[model samples]
Target: MQVDVAILIIIYAYVTTLVVLWFLMKVRPKFPSGISIGIVVFLGIATTMAVVTILEFAIAPVGRPASRVISIARGLKIAAIEETMKLIVAALGILIAKNEAKWVDTKLSLAFVSGFTFGITEALFYVARNSYSLFGLVNLFLSRLIHPVFTVSLVGGILLFRYGKRIEGVLVASYSYLGHALLDHYLTACACYISSAVILLALASFAGAVYLLMPKIEAERKQRGEFEKEATVELKDHWLNKM
Candidate 1:
């Protein structure tokens, strides 16, 4: 019986990896396989966790909150902090890669990979505490997938800024931050007060949202690359003509 269960778990892991890889291919055709991109993801995760640790220490301590409203407010602050962290790390990673003069594929791949690292790291930490049983896997995966995808959804803002769309980038980044905060607020608040079933649905919703939006991001990323290349060429030609 134990052997049978073990075999089943192995099979499940294999299937899960294949499915995840398939979806990843859809969202990013050549992602989860790039070494440098994986490095950026690792760095992004490290940066986010380290910075958040400092932020928490710097912030004032609050006693057990007086009301649900206060608790909710604190949760919202957490969301803001985390969402901001993702943006900052992701943008920083992109800039660093750009400064290195990596191609558009590397730059574009880093954004999503970094965002995914953040989410998967979060999932891993939670799973460590809970330890997985069959019942826990779905909740575990969904919960882990949501936030990174949230950040992935907003990678457009950072990409735009990289392409000289400063105003648009800031606007989109702000919107992304607010949306992340709201989603986190809702999920955290409900999880505290509601059933696991609702939490499951919320997780699924967030993941679905990311899956649906990825193609559009692919379009935007492609279009922005073309625009930036054109501008760069124009600048180069102008300088050469002047010389």
Candidate 2:
């Protein structure tokens, strides 16, 4: 079958850009002012895409002829690298928020935004290459979903950080990387039906996990707000009593 690799690549590029942007708008209301957010988004996307591309090139040679098996291994390696980079970004976001005494939502949202921006830039670059056929395009589409799925894992890592267990955060980040790699390797190397089915299942699982996590994150944000307010009130009263 002459795989319409181009179509698949386009689909992936479109879907990933849409999902990441949608998530950013939905999760982060106070996303800077005007020019700053746009600039940050553009830079984030460019930087991440460059990093991913370099990583892919570096790892591709290890696979030699790029047979199905080797391609699968390469895909996994790329996934691991992408996820790891996203995780590091997420961790840095969390650490910054903690130091600044910012809300947890802000930290989580920033981390996801960085990831989404990264995905969008990568998608555009891949589509621009015009390298794939129908089958290749389909492969690209399926592969693109991994970005958001792995990004959700980064969110989970941020939550672990909120709970004051940085180790748990690291573990969550590593899990995201492994999950991404496993998914990519299997889908790229297996039979078409098997690969498509597994990708669908993974998407469903990712959606469900995100749904479950949202309420918990909201609750935590509210609780933190209350605690902050109470502490502020106590400080005010202490100052008044001293006066």
Candidate 3:
């Protein structure tokens, strides 16, 4: 009902960063099949919401940040639910393609594609239910946009697991979850101290991280033939789609 420092900063930074991501993804990017992407999007929204709702009710006395311990606990719970639900959708193609000896481009693409769609779908619902005004739009950016952007950070992590980097994969996965959880916790419990500058800084840092790892993901994409036939040779990191 009320906008706070954290809310304002999140909205502004998210909207700006999303614009940048759109531009980056425009670079002769290879998109997923229409049917596959559509299925993943539907799966992402339906499963994520359904499972989150079930968990919320099952837990009861949901974390309201009455205390730091409670806040962290709640934040971890939320992170666990979100990560697991998203992964479930991402795993579909992989599970079906498990028998294939060769690499499946579509399976790998599923990770980011599902992530991107899930972020947008969730954002739309959140805006409609909470606020559809300017404030609502900002909320959508924060709540919806960030999830997919953050999940893009998982490209390396997923690859690590796909290839034989078990330890590294676990480490990356852990870091990703903690990073996502910490952001949520801070926004929920420490909103009063957050600022637009801080939000911008976080987004800039994330964009930089994406820029750094995109090459590795694209390298794999190319090796696996996951990209469109027509594309730019040099890939520059603009923002996020990494879904």
Mind giving the per-residue lDDT tens digits that candidate 3 earns over 1-243?
Answer: 355654555455565567446525632334454655666778887876676456432111113455542355676787777776677777763454443313433443566666667666666555455435686465555545555545544544665655676675655666556655666655555453443433454455445444544565567667655443333332433223342
Residue-pair clash count for candidate 3: 1
TM-score: which is higher, 1 or 3?
3
Q: Estimate, for each residue in 55-127, the C-alpha lDDT of model 1 and write its tens digit.
A: 4421111122333322445655766777767766656666655544243434435555666676666656555
Judging by lDDT, tell me the better candidate of 1 and 3: 3
Clashes of each: 0, 12, 1
- Over 4 Å off in model 3, which ranges? 1-12, 15-23, 26-29, 55-70, 94-109, 161-171, 192-243
RMSD of each: 10.0, 6.8, 9.8
Q: On a 0 to 1 TM-score scale, where does candidate 3 land against the true structure? A: 0.63
| Candidates' C-alpha lDDT | 0.51, 0.55, 0.54
Which 10-residue window in model 2 sums to the lowest lDDT?
A: 57-66
- lDDT of each residue in 51-71, candidate 2, tens digit only: 867864321111233364435
Model 1: residues with Cα > 4 Å off, grouped in runs: 1-35, 48-72, 99-106, 160-172, 191-243
lDDT (0-100) at residue 49 of candidate 2? 70
